[model samples]
Target: MLQIDCPWCGPRDETEFSYGGEAHIVRPSDPDATSDEAWADYLFMRTNPRGRHAEQWCHAHGCRRWFNVVRDTVSYRIEAVYRIGGQGPGGSHDPA
Candidate 1:
């Protein structure tokens, strides 16, 4: 079982949280005006990077708060945990 360190609740069992998906996915400003293809892309597309990926995680069984986690996809090792609304260690917005 992997242990995830929650920014608000510290380290906890991975079972206590839910993977929200790749971070920094910006919602369309005018969804209704967007084309079908664009809408579908937003709904289904994601980057499958090999290293250092940023993602969102919700501490469902603990604090119920969401935060950003910088992890390695290849090794499944967490590099950093950060709170929402703040720039991650890499100096980028933790968007989702």
Candidate 2:
């Protein structure tokens, strides 16, 4: 099983958390002005990056707070954890 390090609750089972998809994903404000393709792209598209990746996760069974995590997709190893309002060792936010 994969072990995820929670910033607030320490390392725990992967089942204790829920993946929140790619981090730094900002929803468009002007949905009416955006095309259908744009909306579909935003809703369905995601980058499944290898190596170290910054992602958003919710501590479902722990503190129940949403935070960011840097993990290796290939090895399922976590490098660091950080709160939403703080900076992680891999830097603050993911690419926009």
Candidate 3:
């Protein structure tokens, strides 16, 4: 199993956490003005990149807190872990 390093709880088994899909997905500023297609895209569209991808994870079985992780999609290797709203290796935190 993959080993995840939780920002608050430290290193733990992957089973102790829950994959929260891609991170930094900004919500539509005005849902009423957003078209149906745009709304659907906002709700479902994700960049399933092959290389290093930033994602969200929750330590469900531990602290139950959510955080961001920059991981390699091809190898499942975690590159970095940072708390939500905290700067990552990219030097900025785009809240999801």
Candidate 4:
């Protein structure tokens, strides 16, 4: 029963959203020059941190828009919520 704060739609039930996986993933600047391992890493590698994690979530049932959320993996407590292009409370990556 997580109450997610949608940037455009306010707080809403967790059921209204879809988990969009880990945030702050950077795409290759030159895909043509990128190696296969690098491309594979981009497609597969993810940092599964145990403490606070930054992630993307989409408000599917409400606004149909995607946003970012900072949450504690152990306690499931939301630290902050921001739009897709915005930065989390303590995050450095822009996610845009």
Candidate 5:
């Protein structure tokens, strides 16, 4: 089983958490002015990279808090974990 590190509760089994899809997705600034296609894209579009990818996860069975994770898609290796609104690995800030 994959092991995920919860920023608050320390390392745990992947079963303890829930995947929250791709992270750092920016919502439309003005829904009223957003085109239908743009809105749909915002709602549905996501990056499916082959290597390292940033994702969101929630420690549902533990703290139930959300955080971001940098993981490798092909190898299922976790590169980094950071709290929401905090800096990720290499000092990269969460823009969401």
Candidate 6:
């Protein structure tokens, strides 16, 4: 089982969280104007990085607020987790 470090709750089992996918993905300004490719990209595209990866996740069983987690996808090791506004171990980004 994967272990994740919750910034507010400390290390917890992965079952307590929900994967929110890639962290930095931004939606188009105008969804109506989005093309088929753009829509497809938004719906299906994802960055499956091998090493360090920034991803959005929800501490479902803890704080209801969403947060970012920087972890190694290969080893399933967590690097850090932080709230949306607070400074994390690395950097912060607007929540998706």
Candidates in order, TM-scores: namely 0.88, 0.79, 0.91, 0.92, 0.92, 0.77
Clashing pairs in 6: none
Local accuracy of candidate 1 as per-residue lDDT tens digits, 1-96:
879998877889999999999887888899999999999999999998999999999999998998888999989999888888778876978444
Residue-level lDDT of model 6, residues 36-96, one tens digit each, is 9998999899988889998889989998668888888888788877776556565556644
For candidate 4, what is the TM-score?
0.92
lDDT of all predictions: 0.88, 0.83, 0.92, 0.88, 0.93, 0.81
Among residues 3 or more apart in sequence or in different chains, the pairs in candidate 1 whose N, CA or C atoms overlap within 3 Å are none
RMSD from true fold, candidate 6? 2.5
RMSD each, Å: 1.8, 2.6, 1.4, 1.3, 1.4, 2.5
> Candidate 5: lDDT of 94?
69
**Tens digits of per-residue lDDT for model 4, 1-96:** 999999999988999999999988899989999999999999999989898999999999987998889999989999999877776686555634
Q: How many backbone clashes does candidate 6 have?
A: 0
Least well predicted 10-residue stretch by lDDT in candidate 6: 87-96
- Compare candidates 1 and 4 on TM-score and give the better one: 4
Q: Name the regions of candidate 3 deviating beyond 4 angstroms.
A: none
Between prediction 2 and prediction 5, the one with superior TM-score is 5
Best lDDT among the predictions, by candidate number: 5
Candidate 2, clashing residue pairs? none
Candidate 4 wrongly placed segments (more than 4 Å): none
Model 2, stretches more than 4 Å misplaced?
89-96
How does residue 76 of candidate 4 score in lDDT? 95
The better candidate by lDDT, 3 or 4, is 3
